[model samples]
Target: MTAAEAAADLAGGIIRPLFRSGLLVEAKGDASPVTEADRAAERALRAFLTERFPTHGIMGEEYGTERGDAEYLWVLDPIDGTRAFLTGRPLFGTLIGLLHKGQPVLGLIDQPVTRERWIGVAGQPTRFTSPMGGTAACRPCASLATAELSCTSPDIFDAAGTARFDRVRQAARRVTWGGDCYAYGLIALGLVDAVVEGTLKPWDWAALVPVIEGAGGRMTDWQGQALTLHSKGEVIAVGDAALLPEIVSLLS
Candidate 1:
């Protein structure tokens, strides 16, 4: 197994036992909910990465950055949807990503409860493994009017962002409210057509890039620029690259 896969397993093991166990929930400075599971899982992942990739840098949602200037860096979100996990919803996932020279070259999204994993590497087809069975190819989506659009939540957007999102929602044939990283995996699985979201941090999006792109999709900022470590976090991902021009126009 790859190190990313191992990291997902390690984090998932810590997380599964704590699911809906009524652990004390705390509020981070940003007011986001966090639990002991998130902290413990991240610590374990960090320890494993530090041992296995001694020279690579690490950036995690629960912990601060280390070796920030290293050419190769690992980005992790031990639990992408804390609310979903706290409520025993299985849609939450663990995200692991690797960046080389500031570009995301590898990404993995693992939904532990479902035992589904999506792995994407630069210049290669996205790979998916699940006992449930599915292909990793993106289904063709010709236009926004026929697309199934998804976003984690409307609450994450500001007034202006919400207005922009509403424009697309109005055009889409369907809209789903929450899935976080799991929804992105669905795009790789040919389930979801697109996801438009804003106010995301690096760890939140770093792992989604390769998965969508490698599966015959495209992920970029609302302005249509390629996503990078320095991106402003307005992400627009579509199963069909053809949808980008219309999506960008609507966002503008």
Candidate 2:
């Protein structure tokens, strides 16, 4: 909980002030936006993790990995939604996950501006702290036809991937776009039924596994296998565990 608290505090201290302040946005080689806020937030997180847990490795979105041979590793995506941040939308989140022997043991998703946080500790229920504090749990919705589906956007998919995603989208009751890591948080809160995304990174989806799982939901790769630090990046999450087979079938 110390690391999660530090992450939330760092987001509030370094990130919140930069929101909608017209921070300059630059493009990485992959054309993803990187603002000053993103860099600063990540730097602070990296610093804290290094100082507090010097032996653990650190992997971040802005700064690359800090190669360590420890049994534990810290993953950070200081700003999970740079596009949303650039557009002045509040759909972004700060993602922090601790991998113990390559499995996420603790994870957190914090929306600093909203002052909302969800912490997922392994083998325990996900805890939430919003303006109104409570725990997080996924509500059951076994039928795909009645599920509310969410994805970052349709443009992230390729021609073949798009065709597959279209099938999943069509199977759902409704689809919403542009929620980055916040969608998974919503799923944990029982506000969203399922979330499907293509081409995510380790830092992108690793933190979500424990959050989803702790909330009584299921998260996995498109093939429905468990997610690891080395998964192929295609992710599917369904609130109702029974819906997994059907969702995987559609995605596959």
Candidate 3:
């Protein structure tokens, strides 16, 4: 099976169960929520990669880094949006991305409760599948003027952030709240125009880069910098390239 397919299956099989089981959840030092499901999901993904793609390295959120020197690496966030998961919200998801020489080639975001899978590969079209087994070809909506905007949290922005966010909000036709990792998935599906967030880790944003860019959107830091694995979390993804300058201006 392809890497995208393998990731979907593994995430659904191993990670989804934990969401359903009501596993114990705890807080990390940063106050982010984590659960047994997160650990188990990463373990399952790591084991699968080891056996299937033995030479590939692995990096995950729950578990520390391993085999970092390999030519290819799989970055896993077994559960993104653990806070939503812990609160019984279905906005969380399992994220998997494959990087070749520090560049992402494939990405998969799976929402177990919703059964929504968004997948993308470099140089290919992004696609989304729903729980009822319907599939659709993804495309970024035409322009930002007609676009809808969204973010993980309004509080992500302080007074400065709030001002910047308001600028983008005013420019858009509509703005929706919540969806954490799921927001990026929506951007890939052409359902949302942009998603911005702050205070992110590598795992939080890594898997999302390819998915958004592959879907014919632009993914970058607020200042228009290329997002790297070592990037400090502030991100702005937009379907409309022309709108980016305006959005960036607000952040500036």
Specify the highest-TM-score model's number: 1
Better of 1 and 3 by TM-score: 1
Q: Can you rank all candidates by lDDT, best first?
A: 1, 2, 3
Better of 1 and 2 by TM-score: 1
Tens-digit lDDT string for candidate 3 (94-165)? 888888888878888888788887777888777777867644333545555788888888877778778877
Worst 10 residues of 1 by lDDT: 14-23
Q: Write the per-residue lDDT of candidate 2 for residues 1-252, one digit (tens) a residue.
A: 786787669766888889889778788998999999888988999888889988899998999889645688888899998899888899999999989998889999999888999888899998888997766989989988999999999988889889998988998899999899999999999999999998899899878888999999999999999888778888999889988888889877
As a whole number from 0 to 100, the lDDT of residue 106 in candidate 3 is: 80
Highest lDDT against the true fold, candidate: 1
Clash count, one per candidate: 0, 0, 0
- lDDT per residue, candidate 1, 1-252, as tens digits? 399999999998998889778799999998989999999999999999999999999999989899989999999999999999988899899999999998999999988888999999999999999998887999899898899999999999999999999999999999998999999999988889999999998899999999999999999999999998888999999999999999999999
In Å, residue 88's CA in model 1 sits off its true spot by: 1.1
- In candidate 2, which residue pairs get closer than 3 Å at backbone N, Cα or C atoms, i.e. clash? none
Q: Rate the local accuracy (lDDT) of all candidates.
A: 0.92, 0.89, 0.78
Q: How well does candidate 2 match the true structure in TM-score terms?
A: 0.97
Model 2 alpha-carbon miss at residue 106, Å: 0.6
